[model samples]
Target: MMRWLITGGCGFMGSNFIRYWLKNHTEDYILNLDKLTYAGNPDNLKMIENHPHYRFVLGDITDPQAIESLVPEFDGIINFAAETHVDRSIAQPRDFILTDMVGTYNLLEAARFHQKKLIQISTDEVYGNCPSGQNTEQAPLLPGNPYSASKGGADLLCLAYHQTYKVDVMITRSCNCYGPYQYPEKLIPLFITNLLEGKKLPLYGDGSCIREWIYIQDYCSALDIVIQKGKTGEIYNISTGEGIPNLEVTRLILQEMGMSEDLIEMVDDRQGHDRRYSLDASQIRQLGWNPEYLFSMGLKETLQWYRHNENWWRKIKSGEYQQYYRQQYAQRHKKSTLER
Candidate 1:
């Protein structure tokens, strides 16, 4: 059986990937390593905590000693560890730089020394705003925010390792992913949980910024395909080709929840916010991978998940979440402050 190490497995997409792997790839085993940051919730993977083929390692990727000890025991490493929120990155760019770049470098070093295959999970933000056509794998990197810049730096590091050291590496850049177990700090879950809690949805600027949406499950499937069939030293884009405006997404959520648009509180726009993001994803499609859920269906399922799992989100929205939410949006609540 093939053995794999999945870093950041306690986070949203990572947890979904772990569950997807356990369910579909019975012959493979997974060792999950997560630093359990604010966004990393171990409860997300509680279902698989006791599985025979599953293991959890509480560690940080930036810790060379930690990665060095584990690299020799795995066949491949899929790195999902990153500081992902744009607001968080703006407030603390150093964290993003350290985690996304330095941490990735450590992983690359360990993987290179052990001659282990490595997969770098990245985001479409690295391509910056795609105001016109969809971006292919060869598109130029023009990251706008600290978070994207850090991710872009990590992507470059992975490519550099492949070219300079001949380390087995592959990269997959995906669009915005939404579904169950996502931290409420993100857009979709934030809006859903806000409405559920009787709070006004914080709508940024005019809410015209657009993003390509991909369901978490579909994203996991695409990652699996890349890991199994993708060629080393190559980059793949994974997208559903569904571009929707932030305003429209908020309206849909409000409509689905039987709430009103009046609850949307217009807030100051984020700093260096990209106007749009799109990915061609043709390369991954050539590898026999396609998104299964349409935007409408995915929205419905996501809303239903939040509706039924009130307790799960309630616990998250309490205590630390309240402090974070206030810190993130309190200044934006004013009309004069527009930066970040």
Candidate 2:
């Protein structure tokens, strides 16, 4: 059985990954480390907390001692920890730099010293907005804002460790992920929840920005391939080989929700908003990995999830989310934030 330590296990993608991994790899042991931040809710993993192979530890990645002690104890390290929201990153850039960049540095150093296989879960945002064709693994890094820049910076440190110190690290940059257990503030869930509440479906700018989307389960499957067979010091791009504009995606989700297109609330575009992004996921397919769910099926499933799990996001939309947003960016910005 593999002993694995996973950071950010309480977040959206992290939570889904943990659930998927446990069910698939029954022989593995996972120590889930999360800070239980405003976005993190342990209820996401309540179903598996008592699983014999699963363990939960409340902590932050920036805490060097906390990460160091655990690094030596696990056979592999999968880092899902980060300040993930781009809008929130724009609102609080310093936290992004600290958690996304510095936190990664801390984990890398710990893993390097322990000689553990480290898996860095990343996003396609590192390549910025690719308006035309898809971005291959060699695509130049051009982060358009603090959030992407921070993530790119962390990836650099991972590569540098591999080059300079021969650290065992495999990085996977996946396209925009959507599925169950995601924080309610994200694009799909936000629109879903807003529609249910009869609120405006906030669409940034003209909602024309294009993005390659992948179901969360498929994204996790790619990571599973990386952890099992991918080469160290290499990057894998995970996507569904389909690009959809934010406006069209919103329309599709709203249409499924039985909501009118006029319910969309057009808002000013985000600062440094990406125009489009697409990933060439050929490499992961070469490694015997592929996306399973189509966008239509995934969207329908996600909508049903939110509809069934109102209490989960409702608690977040009310308690921790309100306090965290206010405390982090209340008086700082004056754009009337809506928890994007």
Candidate 3:
């Protein structure tokens, strides 16, 4: 059985991947290493916490020494640890640099030294705004913000390592992912949870910015296929090939939640927000993987999940997150004069 080390396994995408991995690959062993940042919630994987084939370790990937000691024990590594929130990245760029870039450098080093396979989880924002067409893996990296820049830097590092040291590394850059267990800071979950809580949906800018949305389950399957069939030293883009504007998405969320459009509160746009991010996922589709859930179905599933699990997101919106929300949005809220 293969033993894999999953970094940032407590975070939204990572945690969902672990649950997906364990359920599908019962024979494989997994060791989850996470720093347990505010976004990394252990409760996301509580159902499989006691599984014999899976274990959790509290650690940070930024520490080279810790990574060195851990890399030798696993057959391969999947680096998912990252500072992902764009607003937070804008507010605190250093954190994104440390976690997304430096942390990736450390993981690449360990993977190189140990000669182990590494799959770097990435985002489509690295391609910057794709206003006209879908970006293939050959697109140039023109990241618009601190978070994307850091991720883009790490992608370059992975390619560099492969060219210079022959490291077994592959990268997967996907579009926006939404589903159960996602931290409510992102657009979809934020709107869903906000509507549920009787709070206003803070619509950024004119809400005309467009993005492709993919269900987490579909993304997990794509990643699984990539791990099994993808060639080393290559980059793969995963997308649904559908881009929806922010306002339209907000309307869909409101409709799904049975809320009115009046709930949308115009807020200050994010600094350096990309207008669009589209990926040509045709490459991975050749590996016999296709998204099963359409945006409408996926959004409905996500809304139902939050509706059923009110306690989960409610706890997250309180305390520290509340302070963060106010700090991040309070000033921006001032610029808004529209409530509908």
- lDDT per model, in order? 0.90, 0.87, 0.89
TM-score of 2: 0.93
Cα displacement (angstroms), candidate 2, residue 298, comes to 0.1
| Model 2 C-alpha lDDT per residue in residues 298-328, reported as the tens digit of each score | 9999999999999878877768555654344
Model 3 ranges with Cα > 4 A deviation: 320-340
Q: How does candidate 1 score on lDDT? A: 0.90
Which residue ranges in model 2 land beyond 4 Å of their true spot?
Answer: 320-340
Error of 1 at 74 (Å): 0.4
TM-score of each model, in listed order:
0.93, 0.93, 0.93
What lDDT, from 0 to 1, does candidate 2 have? 0.87
What is the model-wide C-alpha lDDT for candidate 3? 0.89
Output the lDDT of residue 101, model 3.
97
Among these predictions, the greatest lDDT belongs to 1
lDDT (10s digit) by residue, model 3, range 1-340: 7899999998889999999998899888888888777887767887987788887777788999878977888889999999999999889899999999999999999999999999999999999998897899999999999999999999999999999999999999999999999999899998888888789999999999999999999999999999999999989999998799999999988877777899989999999889988899999999999999999999989988998998888878886544564344334323322111
Question: Candidate 1 residues 1-340, lDDT tens each?
Answer: 7899899988999999999999999998888888777887767887887788888777889889988988898899999999899998999899899899999999999999999999999999999998999999999999999999999999999999999999999999999999999999999999999988889999889999999999999999999899889999999999999999999999999988889899999999998889999999899999999899998899999999999988778877786544564334324322221111
Clashes of 2: 0
